[model samples]
Target: MAMKMSLKLNSLQSIWYCVFVVVTHAYLIISAFYHYHRVRQMDWPDGTLPKPELGLYMLCVTAALLITVLFIPTQIFQVGNNANDRTKLGVEKGDQGPPKWKGGLKAKLVFVRRYTKHLGPVGATMHIVSAFCLLLPVMFLQAREIEHGLLPPQSIWRSEVSLVPVIEMDRAPSPPPLIDTDLMSTNQPDLKPHVKEPPYKVSMVTINYINYVTALVVYAILYGDVFWFCHKGFALLLSVQLMFNAIQYSLGFIGVSLLYKLHTYGWDKYGIPEPAVVSSAAGLVGLFLTNNITIFLSAVVMFLYGYTRMKESELRKRKNNVEDGKCSVVYKGNALRCQGYIPHMGALCVLVIFIICKSPLIVEYLRAFRHQGDPRLLACMLYDIFYIFFWAFLWVVFALKREWNFNFAYLDEVQSVKEESSQSAGSTGSLVNDNGMKNNIELSFVNRYNQDIHQRHNTDKVTEVKMSPKLHVANNMPVITQASEKYSPKRLRNGSATAEECQLLHQKQEHEPIQNGVLNTSMNGRPV
Candidate 1:
């Protein structure tokens, strides 16, 4: 079997890469937080500054990205470069394997052992920290929404706002002479009504909250193995989570980008609230856009971990005679059915949902809101087009090529059962005793029968047996004649013995003289 090799970062490389990721993410996190604070501080008198909790939510996701990034290196370090190398080296070197250190003060306590059994103390800590980091933004949003009701819906289209400014000469006040410059010109009609809030604030918040809750639940299962305890099962869950998170954020990113353009155009064209409003809002929007890039990069790291875990799981299952699509495996004492196409099908479902939710947003943004030849129009069109295409193509291709039916072989447990049955049969059917002495099966059976006969008979009866010099096989059957108690010759045929015959022979024992037949006896006084 070919060993699957995984690319591993050396210690120095991991350190350097981690340092770079940390430093860059640190800067971005600070920038995002600053922009979030700016948005929170914005003076919107009517509470129309879009989502109030977006800043805090972004901070939560950013923190999770950081921890997940740092966790990448630690997890990578735990994995060996070559799958088989560690096990082979372990056996050859008589190594006791990696040391299991009591993770922390809390993990060392007896009460904590149950929770930490599967993950171990250190792993449980990491999961708890990461899960909380991911959950923080969700709880915050839910609480904030409950405290302050959801924002009101905004217009999908402008009802009375003029597309072009109109100058009314009849209504304009007569200006003073040009020489009296103090009151120079008459006031002009407004170009368009100021758009105080985004058109999709309510929808955006609703979708964002949904995605947040879904992501939190998904990550909980993916990390803590809440639903599926098997490594491969959780790995599949993680992959699905990452894919869904990426797609959800991709949809959000496109929407945010369009909003940025729409807001910038409105601000520039109509001068709605002046550049002061633009600065804070633009900073927040820009922070969201950039933060998505960080998320994508972080997801790539997690995706690698998930992929590695899956491949290792497949390898392990194969070692235990469990193959994908052909057999299931015993995981956590339960049969877990697995196939290569299941996750792909899950990804496909996610893609379909993404299309359903995001397609209209993209169409509306491009066709209705964006002007012809807008700089961002082409880029957004290309991005969403290829984004959907990439996932659709990848998952569809994978799902179609792999088998859908599960064999339900349960190979692991089946193999174990076969081994146990073989062991029992060998132990019971063996011709050797427990003390390593060899004994003939037939001789032992006959000796047991003779002992029963001797116990049943108390009279002293002389029994004589003649030993034949050489026994010849006649018609492939060995026949021995023994004398009965009435001197009647009884024939003993080989390979034709049964429990009933043995019982009958014991019940009516007749050891008479050997008249015309000879019996060959061994030193134990039993016929061989």
Candidate 2:
């Protein structure tokens, strides 16, 4: 059999990957539910809730349920079966044989495998549609907030006095009425009225829901697969989204900071007094930070996917010599030399940074307990706490414990098969051709049969050829001999060939001579 590189997922790694996927999906679903409940309980001042946000959250819940139903169980069952098969075989036997499934399990496996082929198309469509649905609504909401004075307007002069006409009053010839009492009142018109239109209501529920759904769909379509273009597409989408969010929030953060500074130090100079500026700054910062965390995590995930794909490609290109049917070089004694630890560590660092970024929200949540505050702030704090711990546990189990690594099959691991004519002359000793030429013939074969060993190798059949006691040649026919043995390639233990074995094979190859003026030869003991 021609050798080709292939992914060699072990039972443990497969199980860990399954667990990670299931837990991550569960977290997303719970988050969606929390968002839905939070948004539903919110009441706008005009008594109209954000219906678009509610619908998007509901769609996210539906998508989560569909993913759980369609993907999670199949992955669990597959991993479970794999673990069971490995356990039954024991470490000594190893994973050389094809997995055997019986009864209902086999049927279930077949059904899931067949149905998941369509998930790619379905998932891709869902991801693109959901992104637009969530983004457009959020954009509209932001514009609406600015228009209604719930959020800070673009410019105080334009928003407050753009329509007012400037008038100059000549000094009154007559003495001012009410004398000094009216002079005490300054010319500061009440700016509070202009700034107090309505409370800002920015619901992240819809955006969060959409992001969760998109992530889930993309993962379902790409997880545990080795399609290069699919991985690249996923990475590109994540990068684009991350850059967009980063730019948007950075601008928002900078603008809010400038407004807060202006309100603090130069408000009187600008002749503007809006008490809500502090709250506006806090709200905008919190909102932007929350979104930044979400987008950063998504980017981290996509980066990991791309990194894994690159590792796979590198493994395929690796060239190593084979000694006794095993690759001479084994990476850290692991069959699967996958790349995982670096990405896992990177994820942990990102999670820690996320926790740090949410500190302001945590403080706000604490203050909210003492005074009136946005419930969304409290909700975000709680979610951040949960998010941090959930990922911490995931890192401990999958990354820290190093369960993410797997074995890959390299080309050198493949065993070559020798094919020779099975037909035999009467005997193997002396043969006489019809032209009266005499030739000496010899055949030697070894037979080693072990059923457990045979099953372990998963070879279809093992043939052993032996030398006949006598030989007779006629009609100028040549006597051909083929060697076979019960040794199966699958069960061939991974190790370097001993000095004696290497020397014997080298000497045999070097000293062997062609016969009958025919240049018959074998490369690596396989007839050419």
Candidate 3:
């Protein structure tokens, strides 16, 4: 038989997924600083300096850092509350809570040890990755300062010495040819300095200094949140962080365009060194591409989380009002109908924006590749190529297979299984009926609704009823009174249900209630 599958990611899978994101982001950070430093070193022929425009790049890493920071707390909460002793250290739900400020050093250390023992791998990985992220900017700043020189050039003008033969003096007859070497030295022409190239003011050093410092401060604050194990606090912080990330990634395309324009300017006007252009472009592409993917994944995770929570909340609400079964059905249908698909829609929008921002960069880089083939460009292209597969995997594995309170299945697989079963049954006539009864089935909304209405209105005092599919419905209405007493839950449990009765049971399980009095059901019959 074809088995039902759910694509929801468990904790382990989610952690690994986030690890992929974190690794990519870390590379992006390293690449950004490396190339930014390289670009800063180039003294353009036109005296113009290239701008790395690290404002967005800084935020990009900051977003990644904050997300990692948030993840630590989430993990802490999950672990502390976990009942699985094998997965947790000594920490449990009521293990005297986290260390307080008034606690002694030993107490604090003991408290830290409990959580850290369980979270060591995850925390250590984050710290290692984030340390590079935090320190690279400062290194870039220092390198930029030392490279462009401790002080701006005193004079913008550069003078060149040229030796020109004193033809007029040579033509003039000398009084006498001195036998001494001093006479020959006297003929040496005086050197004259001519101003050839002038330097233009480059403010990139100051601009980057400010940018990197601000980024460092912002990143440090987020980093501090890592040790703070308050989920509620992180939730609030994440809202702001997410908003900032959204704005940055949304305008990331503009940053790319600007960087491209700067590179074009240098290449066209001054014939800037090719390596400089390539490095700058590579960094720009990698930064934005990776950053966009990171943010997109983050958005997907957030939406999926919210979607799961909404489902749980609804289920809780339904269970709490079990006595009002009809209200529960109506409430669930209306609520889900209105809001169930928001997460999918939101994720799709993020994906679309990600594509829009990254597509132009890919095309631009392709053109760059034609000009000069570099490993950096190849790396970017690889990211783009793999990103396509990643999107497919996410959609197919996470979105489509999700339990949306609607039947979603691999139709071909189901059909193949059904055909195989039928062929086997045909070869064994004695077991054919039993095989058919065991086959999975589904009920249509119309038939299910008829059955529900019939149950409510009929005077039958039966605790439960099961009937053969052939006798259950006629003319779109439930023929409940006609059902025989041969089928029951006990009989089905004992493996004695006939094919018709088993099919009816399967149909009953798949039945989804229609929204009554809220939505018009007149097309089916009349609103309940």
Candidate that would win on lDDT: 3
Give candidate 2's error at residue 133 in angstroms: 7.4
Q: Per-residue alpha-carbon lDDT of model 1 for 214-258, expressed as tens digits? A: 433433333323213234444454456555544545445444543
Error of 1 at 88 (Å): 15
Clashing residue pairs found in predicted model 2: 335-407, 336-406, 336-407, 336-408, 427-470
- The digit string of per-residue lDDT tens for model 2 on 134-197 reads 3323333343344344555443212110233333334334434455567676654333322233
lDDT by candidate, in order shown: 0.37, 0.37, 0.39
Q: List the candidate 3 regions with Cα displacement exceeding 4 Å.
A: 1-129, 135-139, 142-306, 309-339, 367-372, 396-528
Write down the lDDT that model 2 would get. 0.37
Q: Which regions in candidate 1 have their CA more than 4 angstroms from the true location?
A: 1-10, 26-255, 260-341, 368-372, 403-528
**Candidate 3: 10-residue stretch with minimal lDDT:** 426-435
How do all models score by TM-score?
A: 0.33, 0.32, 0.31
Ranking by TM-score: 1, 2, 3
Alpha carbon deviation, residue 212, candidate 3 (Å): 18
lDDT of 3: 0.39
